[model samples]
Target: MEFRHLGRSGLLVSEISYGNWITHGSQVEEDAALACVRAALDVGITTFDTADVYAGTKAEAVLGRALKGERRAGLEIFTKVYWPTGPGRNDRGLSRKHILESIDGSLSRLGTDYVDLYQAHRFDHSTPLEETMVAFADVVRAGKAHYIGVSEWTADQLREGHALATELRIPFVSSQPQYSMLWRVIEDEVVPTSEELGISQIVWSPIAQGVLTGKYLPGQPPPDGSRATDENGGRFMQRLMSDEVLSRVQQLKPLAEQAGLTMAQLAVAWVLQNTNVASAIVGATRPEQVLDNAKASGVKLDADLLKAIDEILEPVAERDPARTYETSPKERP
Candidate 1:
């Protein structure tokens, strides 16, 4: 597997990392999840990304147990905070209490004393940025986490947080955003800001929620057991499941053939072409899927193929950075 440094930090992660967002606890059985993890390891994937809010906080436990016997020093395990993990008033957000309390719970669930990286799942508009950064600093000082990151954050929010992270002298090294051939929201602002601040993007949904896989054929029912058909796991994918999007995706199969890549590999490789992207996070329910995605690591697409992809997908691609997230005052746990 090819590896790259996480931002300007001294840590290197596999270019194609494994992520269990909707698969570990909600979409697959424990044995299946464990099998996928093993497949990732067998194929040389050393990075795994999960979030505290994924599968109602059960994904972390499954991933923790799956990697129970692996050498911890050889893996880069990452998880995020700032989401409601419990029904309490102080169980969420980037507040000092929440970050402090949440880290202990995460560590306990993951069976690890520290995570390689702990990210803020979202910008907590309700919490003071100072309180949040100080809490992160404490976590690093206490050896609970090695570095900090943010997910789906606007460029402005990232700049604000980076300023505080620098002031506190914390290692803010990564940004996790949903980036793909069809999702260019991060390219305009987030990428530029991250380039300026020494942060690398660990992008999720590099296949645009499987649309780029060319499995959801146009004018047909989504394949059974596909992400677009799963009730709980498919909610966020509805936006990309439109007929227009599916039709556009179908047109990419010939390009994949010409490039000697599967549609999924093309999609993942497309994201990695950006120098600022440290890794592309791929989720899988089957072991073979992991194997397919891992091959995208070192595959380089020529300039003509890339231009063809843009021409075919640009009309339907979502590029408005503002659509990435909506931030405002709200109660966060």
Candidate 2:
């Protein structure tokens, strides 16, 4: 697997990393989860991403169980905070109280003394950004977290946070965002800003929550055991399986065929095309899925093939002109 520098930090992560978003605790059993982790390691994936809110905090526990004993030292584990772990109001956000308490809980659950990287799951509009940054800095100083990051943060927020980290003498190494073939919003603002700020962009949902994998076709019934079949799968996504998106996916099938790769592999390769992207965090339920996603690391898309993909996706871009427009036009222009 190809390794890239995670922003300006000395750290380097594999091009394709493994994550437990909706699969570790909610969907797959322990044995299956262990097998998937093993597959990722076998393919040279050193980073594993998890979040405290995923599966109501059970995902971390499952990951801890999987990485128990000698195997834990061989991996770089990353997890996030800022989501409610319980019904209580104190259980969520990046408040100093929550941030202070949450990292300890995550440490205990993950069966590790420290995480390689700790991220804020989202911008905490309620708390002062300084408060949150100081709390994260404390963790780093205390040896509970090695590096700090934020997820789904706006350009302004990221800039402010970076300034705060510098003032506090804390190093913020990365940012995680939902980026995929179907969602290119980050390219307009987040990508460029991250590149400028020397923050690594470790993207999640690189497959558009499985939309680009060609699993849900237009007019077809939802596949058995798919994420769409879950109770939390809202009506919006259920209705999103439109003829247009599926047709676009169908058009791209031959491109994958010519490359001697699966559509899923092509989808992943497409996400990693951006040089600014440090890593793409892929979620997998089975060992084979891990193996399949890892294959994308080996399949390089040339400039011509990337142009072809852009052409194929142009129709979808036209449909959502607002999203296609950059929110930060000043940065773009």
Candidate 3:
């Protein structure tokens, strides 16, 4: 696998990182999850991303077991905070109490003393930004995490957070955004802001949650056992399952053939075409999927094919920078 520096930091991560979002503890059986993780490592993937909120925090434990014997120094493990991981008032958000308690729980579940990157899963509207940043600073100072990052945060949020992180002398180095050929929301603003702030984007859903793989047919029922058929894990994918989006995605199959790649590889490589993307995070339930996605590393697509893809997906792609995220009112702490 090809490697790149995560943002401007000295730390390097595999360009195609393995992420267990929906499949680790909820979507698939433990044996399948372990096999997939083994496949990723066999293919030279050294970066793994998970979240405490994923599968009600069971994903981290599953991942911890999968990586139990691996050398810690050779892997870049990333996890996130925020989102309700428990039922109590202090169970979520980026509040100082939540951050402190959450990190310890995450480390315990992940079976690691420290994570390479600890991220805010979302901008905490309820907590003061200073409180969150200071908590993150404490996390770093305590050696629980090497760097800080935020996921799906707006450009404005990133700028303010980075300023505070700088003031606190924290190594804030990455942004985990939902970027793909079909989701261009980050391109208009977040990419530029991240570039300026030395924050590289480790994009999730590079295949538009598998829509770009051409597996879902237009106006047809979703295949059995696919993400769209999952109750707990497919909520975010519902938006892109429309006939219009599926039809547009189907048009890219020929382009994948033209590029000498499978539809999934083509989709993954398409996201890496952007210079600001440090890595594309992919989740898999099968070992074959892991093997297919890892090949996306170092596969360069010509400008002409990229233009053709844009033309095909233009009508259906979500490009508005305003679509970054839903600003839910701060949950009562």
Taking all chains together, each candidate's TM-score versus the true structure is 0.98, 0.93, 0.98
lDDT of 2 by residue, 93-169 (tens): 88898888999999999999999899988877678889999999999999999899988777677899999999999
* lDDT string, candidate 1, 141-257, tens digits: 999999999998889989999999999999999999989988899889999999999999999999988889999877789899898889876888887888999998899999999
User: How many Å off is the CA of 83 in candidate 1?
Assistant: 1.2
**In candidate 1, how many Å is residue 196 off?**
0.6
Candidate 3 lDDT tens digits, 1-333:
899998889999999999999899999999999999999999999999999999999999999999999999999999999989989988989999999999999999999999999999988888999999999999999999999999989999999999999999999999998988888999989999999999999999998888888999987898999988898657888889889989888889888998899999999998898989999999998999999999999999998998999899899888999887653334643
Against the hidden true structure, what lDDT does model 1 obtain? 0.93
TM-score of 2: 0.93
Error of 1 at 213 (Å): 0.7
Model 3: ten consecutive residues of lowest lDDT? 324-333
